[model samples]
Target chain A: MRDIYAPRIHGIDTSEIRKVFDLAAKIQNPLNLSIGQPDFPVPAAVKEAMIQALTDNKTGYTPTAGLVQLREAISTYLKPKIGFETEPDNVIVSTGVASILFLLFQTLVAKDDAVLLLDPYFLIYPALVKYHEAQQYTIPESFDEADVNSLNDRLKKDGKKLKLIIFASPSNPTGKILSETQLRLLSNLADEHDAVIASDEIYEAFDYEKRHVSMAKLSPHRTLTLNGFSKSHAMTGLRVGYLAAPPAYAGIVQKMVTLQQYTMVCSPHAMQWGAITALKTGIDAELSVMRKRRDLVYGILSKVTKLPYPDGAFYVYPDVPIDSADFVTRAIERRLLLVPGYIFSANRNSIRISYATREDILEEGAGIFCDMVRELG
Target chain B: MRDIYAPRIHGIDTSEIRKVFDLAAKIQNPLNLSIGQPDFPVPAAVKEAMIQALTDNKTGYTPTAGLVQLREAISTYLKPKIGFETEPDNVIVSTGVASILFLLFQTLVAKDDAVLLLDPYFLIYPALVKYHEAQQYTIPESFDEADVNSLNDRLKKDGKKLKLIIFASPSNPTGKILSETQLRLLSNLADEHDAVIASDEIYEAFDYEKRHVSMAKLSPHRTLTLNGFSKSHAMTGLRVGYLAAPPAYAGIVQKMVTLQQYTMVCSPHAMQWGAITALKTGIDAELSVMRKRRDLVYGILSKVTKLPYPDGAFYVYPDVPIDSADFVTRAIERRLLLVPGYIFSANRNSIRISYATREDILEEGAGIFCDMVRELG
Candidate 1:
């Protein structure tokens, strides 16, 4: 048979996280720390809201953008938190932050477009850029003032102009939240290069050390803030998320909504009702629990390997002494599932451990990881 | 500000159906015959299943392709109806059929690839092809043996090679189900052109005349059957759908699943559990109600306009005497929402009336449509 797929299909190879999931599925009760979603059950109130919506016959399609109440609720929720007065018009509710990101890329990024990335980023960033045939440039050194200047110099030297810059803070694998000063510098870089900043704030609620800041706050004129309830309220399966565009990008947001109409049609209708309830519900208690888990995991893993102290999100990326792929393979053999750092960065000396699991599992998984590092080191 | 969007964004213009929706939103208690979804509430069993799933805390992410049991249920459901033995591996559950179509087109169709669209098609087809920069060829004459032959000749004359053929049976506007002979002929054409068949069977349950024949039944080697519970079980808001690929297209299915992983991630998880229950439930009673509504609608409209006899789905496309857009405008003035035929086809002399609303509303809407036709004609 003829090859019935486009060339772009080859670029979107399955991520290593999926491989970890596939491997974990075979092992009985593996001490799993490779998952990215929160392990907490959805709050009772949110579940009841969705149930009520279903019972009320809200099972038909909502407007393509989403339910009006949900959009308004999202706007109200973000106004205080995102440090901006947002209106319902600025929001486009989607299946998840992942889906919104997909639409954003499809709408904005094109062939040969320069998409800048931070090292050890969300695994989807490179794949999305590659899928669009965009030119990808990553700052692999470190996230610092010096690194921003180095990135600017490298771009100028290579004669590359950045079209889009994507980063998740409190990032997925690293859980390192960028400082306000760092955000300002990157925002300035975006202004200099005339690029759009896609700030993935899905982990916004997970900041442990300080208050969470959004790129939407630092550079509202050019930043697209991506967030969802999956992690914060533990509603990953509901697949509801939204992207908030600044007033300057309302036209572009409209275009993304149109694309979404042809693609997702709309997010699940009943779930949007649940999301409305979630906006009013706080996760402070849950955040405290995760904060302790983060402290415990980092405390254990740091004993054997050098890694950055994660301040946000639920993951810690540790620089292992042995090959990270080999380290993960050995960990799998020990009935522990962990993702290698190559999935997030070109570098292969580290592994990402998500502390989103229960405390006992996180503790046991971290111990197993440290033991493996010592044996292989 | 710089134009922060790709050129492809311009190709996906918002459809006229959305315009109708916007206009209808402004009207109070409009006799609505413009919506595509079934008006029936989601079945009680399905709703309870989703509620149960939520209560059981299946609110975390499922595997990207969807829950294993849902995939298995989908396979089992299709095996007898599609005239082929299906396995769970051949299925990929997605957010909706529209979403699966998006992934399928993104995975397979590339720029300049020729896509064959049946005329008066679902509005999304042309937009999807245009967004991909694919060359689109439509058979706008009629749906019959002659039209298929004419399409083959036209393709040859234009020196165009067909890469894909997309059609919905028990189609949206026309509600005309393709006969088994027609399916066999189109399958032969697909074989001749070496094109893949995307049989959109979302309205499979809406067939009232004869057994709905799927292209998959005739051309399993090169067919991708797209179906969902949205229309059948009235779970449109739940956004759960699946694609069944033939054994020959397993590799392509895997690629689409990967694309979906980076995009939709998975269908709303709890909804998939509901879908599993939906597969075991019957919608024959509700389908019968729609069948009678179809008869009521066609009977009234045929008195004033020329249209094909609709045997399935919930819509009837009638050729109106006045400009179809103007007719829709006039209808809106009278608080009757109808979609212009040009929204679905190049021809502008017809309009689509959905009988998916209540029978009284359908009757009143049909009467209003006839009165307007007589006055304008």
Candidate 2:
């Protein structure tokens, strides 16, 4: 009976982050800092566009790639922002950025093909590779001098088998943005190795320090830019995202589209209309609010705890006084929901607190989290 | 450069059906008929529910499996319909039936494993198996008693390796429904051999002859029922569907959910609420109109050529006077958009005409199609 399933699906488990979400649902009015999406409701204009699409009966399948107009909109919007030109054909709407990543991996990864991932990375990255029976190699922490040199060594060793490198800007769990120098070094390494980079910039619009730089802007020929409106527009459930690759990868990208044509089809049609509005209106208001919440959390947490300097997205990862899983369990017992960093990383040492909630709740949660760490110490 | 792609994706191209769609879009308002969706708009109640969900600020992620109430709604509705009760946990909501089928095959089909498919089958099924690097053996034409005998021998030869059988009820292209006796034989055969049946019942509500019979109803343990709102509620763009399996395969199904969690997240949340309403309201009115279109197509095509008597769905597959591809091309020149059967079938002789359009358009297109066949003869 156990053998009735596909070989790869054995030993599978639910994401630990999702488990926290489930446990959080049972608690009443806890200061929840464990959310993975923005706390704001979708913008009125975007919601209105979706509503209008429903009224107009735009509830049928769009072209397999996406609505051409939305693809065109994404192309125009991303070009100036990323400092690169793109045709509409380069953009493909997906159910969400999650899906684009999945399809991209499925399209490009073969068994034993290795993809380089930065450790303390997004949890799903390695999982996607594993599902495809691909080998995953991790670079410790950041693309600092040592890590970059290590990458060059690993690429030389793996040669053509090291097919991809994936990382996120304003990365999940830890909201660390990759510096331009680091991205440029990565681009050079990829060129030397003849590999590709999957730059996940879903959090691109949430940047607070320098303006977000797309890796694709620096190395369009070797980058597949994966992005979405879920975070910026507070439209997580709307499932609107796009993947853009340089035309050099069009043949492979088209194969990805063909796989999706039979599987996921296009992204949600009405929500794609909402995304058209999202790109048009921009996410300034939401970003400003997220910035404030981040400031509030940082102001409190940095006082008592060792943490990474917050730059973008909505989370702040801090080293815990206790084991990561234990810290998360204790927080849950105290009616606080914070995710353990080990859920996202290779080690069980830190916890992630999302500041995406309103200022007051995030402030309160931050204070409690700090107090809890102090008490444990 | 082709070497940059994954081994499986190299030979992939756009679906032949999609090729027809691309060519059709270039033509002016000819008697268009190459649709695969209901011509009617989404039900007003369903559309309004989606509107209200959006307005109510339900624009954040639901659980990866789906909204609880929606899953519960599907479970309750399907219990009576499928003759076996399932818990909400057994129903996994997906972006569309397309995504579900993709994940299902990706999860179950091991490389080199052989799965049985009905020829003239839905185009996506074989493509999915191929993409997974699995073997696909097609059963000749339809599933009759002889076909069942052939299936048993194939299963015996392949033994445990031949693990899956996939077919659609109220099938696409031909709109043929499997009789209960045929279904029972398949179910018994599956039980005997420890194989599984993937019952694609996306067109369940559109069945016009006998009440739609679910393959899951007879063999819940070995049947994975795939159904969705896109076909029945005219909500193709809404991207809501479910894969229901028995508790025995919860482990396998959980893996499918994990893949989607890392990839698709969940189906569009607001559209899922519409699906809840879709189940509650049913699709009686839409089914009645489609029945008229089915009858209209049968009346015109039956006179000119040999064709399957379509009992449900919105298509009538008719044998043509020339090669399927040649006939499809010829029809396009005459300003009609008919899909050739080779796009859905193993051979290249018949073409499929969709009657999911207005009566006048169907009549005009059918006449043109018949005249073209006569001219070719």
Candidate 3:
């Protein structure tokens, strides 16, 4: 019975972040700073569009790629923003950015194939590479020159086996945006190794300091741009996202669609209509409110400990004076929820705090978190 | 450049059923019978429930398994119907039944593992097996005692290599329900070989001739029962489905939930509420209507060719006088759409007609189909 599972799933456990979510659910109105999605409701126009599509009986399967009109809307909305021509043929609507990553990995990464990761990474990255029985090489910390050199040496060693270089911009667990120099270096490394760059830009809308840059804008031929509306439009439950492959790699897009035809069939159809409307609705007010929350959290936490400056997304990772697991446990006892940094990295001295909640709640949680760190230090 | 793809995805093509769908979209108001879902709009109660859930701001992610109340509702409803207890712990909600199949195959089928298939099977089965690089053996037409003997010999030869024995009862193309004796025999075979049974019963609600018997009721320890609301409530686009394993096999359910956490995150959040309503609302009227269409199709097609008796689902696979590819093309030229049998089986002399559409269109299409066969014969 123990042998019932394949080798791919043998040691893969439920994500530790989801465990924190479960723990938060058990507590009675704790100041929760562990959620990964925005704390806002979906826009009215988007909800209405979904309802109307249901009323109009758009309740059957869409084309395996997605609704034609929705694909067109995504393409039209993406071209100018990403600074590249996003043809509708290369845009595939999926259940979420997560599914796109799964499909992309399933299509490209073979057993023992190498996927380079920039640490600290999103937890799902290594999980996917592991599930495909692929080899993962990690460059500890930032994508600076030192890390870039390490990546170059690793790719040179692995040669043709390095199939992908995957990273998130405005990354989860850390919210650090990759600089243009880093992106360019990665593109060059990918070109030399014939590795595709999978750039996850789901947090593109949350860049507070500077405009977000897409890897496709820099390396159009070899990059797969992954973005979705979950964080931006507050539609996590609606589960709609898209991936744009350059026309030069339309073959990959076609293969993914065929895989999607057997797996997801298509993303939720009525919700896709809602996503089309979401593209037209602006979240500037919400963005401004979140920016203030980020500022407030940063103002409080940086006073107490060494913290990475987060210019985008909704999270801030701060070094804890004590073990992060011990600190997280103590915070839970005090009715505060946070994810330890070890879940996202090999390092175990930090915790991730999300500022995506109500400003008052996030402010109160930040004060409690700082007090805990001070008491322990 | 072609070497960029993994060997697993090298030879897979988009489903031919999707090709027919694309062809139907290009034609004008053709009497379309190739579509796989119910033509009726989703039930009003389900639609209204989804609307209410959205309004109530249940728009964030649910637990990876599903919403608690929805899982409980599914458990409560399935117990009496399946003649066994369905615990929430052993159920996992997924994007669709197709997704569940994908997760199940990915979790259990190692490289070169054997999966026994009953033909004419759903097109997605082999595609999933192929993508996993597994071995698939087919039992050509039905599950008669002769086929059972062959299965026994195959299982004996394969020994521990057979990881799964999968089939769709109230099947997709043929709509043939397995007899209880057949289910008992397969369960014994699975028990003897330590293979799990994957019983796809998505069409259970559409059974017209007799009450559908679940394989889980007889072999609770070995069977995984998959059912969904897509056909029952006409909510195909809502993308919610569940797979219930025995409490003895809760480990499999847990592994699938972990897989879902990374791949789908969860099924569309608000739609799970709609699915809760779908369980309580009866669709007897829709079932009866589909039964009449089944009768009408069997009547028309039996006169012209050898047709498999379809007692469930929305399709009938009838042998054609000409090659099925040629027959499907000829039908399309006359503004009718049908799926050639080779898509589902090695046999290439049949076409699948879906009676899920309007009665008038089905009637018209049946007449055109008979005339074409007569002229060709």
DockQ winner:
1
Positional deviation of A106 in candidate 1, in angstroms? 0.7
In candidate 1, which residue ranges exceed 4 Å CA deviation?
A140-142, B140-142
What residue runs in model 3 are displaced by over 4 Å at the alpha carbon? A157-161, B157-161
Error of 3 at A50 (Å): 1.2
Error of 3 at B322 (Å): 2.4
Per-model DockQ: 0.85, 0.75, 0.75
- Give the per-residue lDDT of model 2 (tens digit) for B1-377: 43876777764558999889878988898787888888888988888899999999989999889998998888888898778777788789998988899878878888877787777798888787877778888775466778877766876677644678888888887888877887888788777667778999998888887657899887888888999998889988889989888888775568888878877899999998999998988677777888888888888888889987787888888998889998888888889998989878777888888888999999999999889878887
Cα error, candidate 3, residue A58 (Å): 1.5
- Candidate whose TM-score is highest: 1
Give the RMSD in angstroms, all C-alphas superposed, for model 1: 1.5
Clash numbers, per candidate: 1, 2, 0
Candidate 2 per-residue lDDT, tens place, A198-224, comes to 998998888987657889888879888
- Off by more than 4 A, model 2: A157-161, B157-161
Compared with the true structure, what per-residue lDDT tens digits does model 3 show for residues A120-179?
899999998887889988886566778777666866676644689999898887888888
**Per-residue lDDT of A39 in model 3:** 85
